[model samples]
Target: MTHTTLSTAQRDRAAGVLLGLACGDALGAGYEFGAPLPDHTPVRMQGGGGFGWAPGEWTDDTSMAIPLARAAAAGLDLRDETVLDGIVAQWVDWAKTAPDVGVQLRAVLSRTEPTASAVRQVAKAHHDRHGRSAGNGSLMRTAPVALAYLHDPAALAEAARLVSSLTHYEADAGDACVLWCLAIRHAVLEGELDLRIGLPALPADRRALWEGRFAVAETSRPADFARNGWVVEALQGAWSAIVTTPATDATHLRLALDAAVRGGRDTDTVAAIAGGLLGARWGASAVPAEWRRIVHGWPGLTAADLLRLGSSATPDLAHAQAESVDYAYLGDVSTLVRHPHDDGVWLGAAGALDALSAEIDAVVSLCRVGTKQVPTRIRHRVEVRLIDDDDPAKNPNLDVVLLDTVQVVAALRAEGHTVLLHCAQAQSRTPSVAALYAAVHRGVPIDRALAEVIAALPAAAPKRFLRDAVVRLAEANTDSPHQGPNTEGARA
Candidate 1:
């Protein structure tokens, strides 16, 4: 428990990265419409318009990022119907409001653009029509794809190129997507800032290896220093800034903000994408909290919840869901451990499915304000919750819907005798309620039971995200705390 390499405090602090990215995103979002910033705050909005978005509201940038991640997490292949469907569905959500999506993207999404297939249709179209297009827009939202395919650089390139063509049909745009995806892949997985590794020098022959390519955008000229209108310039700018910056944790992030604020037509999006890449390099933790507190993602997707959710859900990944081992941190401890809850270690895909299903079942049951699970065989359902100290009426979205839980649990119980108990992470909060349930049904001691869990997972089981969630669970109960000698009182 007292490992010298990382203290509990350090572990908790490192867990802040994911939160950091969302904050940066939300904070920067304030200026997305080219809004003016008060002198006190940094200016991230510039150019023709302001983001007009409220704090925490992400634009097409972050929204598009998740499904790509989902697709990648599911498989490296963007061609997979599941992956493509996921991507198109997210885009469709955006099109619902801002229907005037970028040209190529709109066509692909509509499936009216004469695409031969999903894999390289967009890119090929650009090659055929635009002569050569390399737009930074393709690069901006490339992180999720990079993250999903962190293990496969070439695959990352292909996917990035494909998605890029959805909006941009030029080779430069395609290359921009490939290069930026490469950059983000390095940033997120390799903790790299330099473009030299996977993204070769621009206007170079790197594209020939994948497929014969040329950067023929009129906007790009060797002497023009590609800027404002050229995707290559923005892509290269991000690369240069990320690589050459002072290495201050958020330095690259700041530069990205700089890009968006003054970045003219595509300012905000470019800023968002650049910040994402930079944030990934900094492990998402380096983003400022002020910003993350404000950055908003949609109901099912967002920076705020994704990584944290990932922390727990990661352990529950189905076999087919994992891509590569990437990196594992025993939290703040310097030593590395095999990543648990990953598809890699689970004897391939089948083991993953079994584990994921089990984990989801545990989550569904354990965190229920209410839940539904068809418990096969003898089924035990446990629900634990802590009421908000301030208000009983207010509900955090994370809690399960009460009616749904009741319906499922009721039906299951009707099928057979069901074992169900609800407890908070802290025994005290859950105790009174648990005691009530115990009187009515089978129940276990709340306080004493969780203590054993803590002891068992002193190093291994309670990953940081899971541990924090437990703390929150205990917090909701507010009846007892996890610190000190009293931990064993419940005989747990």
Candidate 2:
């Protein structure tokens, strides 16, 4: 498949696929195999399931998908047998030490040599012997297949089936993968959900069967699919959770995944499945920063790694490292001024990071910096991905990113850690975020906060778009009940 250039929205959605999947996997990890959760019960990544997952840690569902994501990111075709073999080899290595593995996948991997041909033979033999191999295992990790062939629906359908056949020979498993992958592709490209879009690509009989399944899902709730361990029911349960939930805004991504977890049995798999589509439709920007901050698992990967993998999977969307800036050319990089309302928070330019004081244990970076720019001694450091540009397209999740950054700063300060908030210069991004922090956390009016923040930073001049966003955030906060600054709570 040739690389297809993606729009900003398309790029964000493409990166969101794996992120959404991991977030859902971690969220549901603590509830796997449990009965349905009661309505209004708060769903958190508390982490106490059969596998003893750490809070916000993803499970085998994401672990199994990583190799495929890595391959796609490296620009390898998923339909190629050699690439599939490499994926199987990685899975074999992962299974040896994985905290948890699916029963069917374990049966095949444990007994066979780690080769595509050998693994397929063992999988076929297992299916033939028991007449049942349509487990949810294949479908759970099929999200990356969609990213590999987003430009061609026909190739996507073929690759989805071929990849699924590596460990699941059943037609049901392959069909479910094809439909779900096609749906994810559609969501990423078209910004909509349509499970039936790939129906015609399947055999006529199977197409009809899937159509009926979708019907059942649309009319019911995720909890209605009691046998979620099966591939068909897993798809139904995931789709039901998505369609049943009202996606009025980006928060729908979280709500739908929560609904999937509440569907009871095999909570992690179902939620992970739903998350792929939801993330594709909403973009990585739609995912909550709280989840992005903590979600990690398998092979020692973090949320940032997931974002990189997902972006790299789409060759055209591969992120280029930010160009290094000459700190010497920019005037006085050491301008550190205390926040007007909160003395514990210091506002400054990137140069201030050259010699951070011992009192500042936390740092919120608004500009891109080198790997070692932040001191190792700092206990908390959040590198916000806010670009120093006025173009709306440059910062798709401007509002969310801005608020989340302020919240992180406030949370850090509330925990009694002095915080440093800075950008490349003390100009656009830094002062804007600092002012936002004052408005929301310090309970100052938006205009007064901006004026105070400007007065503190002599060179402060926020761009039109960012300044507008601050005003909007302040208005929204004022319209609602004033919650204290630490709304998101301290980071783990």
Off by over 4 Å in 2: 317-335, 350-354, 367-379, 387-396, 479-492
Number of the top lDDT candidate: 2
Candidate 1 lDDT over residue span 1-492, tens digit each: 011122222222222223333443444444443433322244532212253565456655556555555554444467455556556666666655652244445544555323324524655565567665555555555665555454567666777776766656676777666666676556544455545455453345654542221233222222123353467665543444344445553344554455344433444454555565665555433443334323556554443345433222122223212332221221321221111211111111111222233322221122222111223331233222223232322222112222223233334344443223222232223223222222222232334434443332223222223333344454444454445334552332
The numbered model that scores best in TM-score is 2
TM-score of 1: 0.51
TM-score of model 2 (CA atoms): 0.90
| C-alpha TM-scores of all predictions | 0.51, 0.90
lDDT of 2 at 324: 41
Model 2 Cα lDDT, one tens digit per residue, 305-422: 7877898887774333323445767787788999988999999998888888878888887776655677869746676678777777667677878888888787787789899999
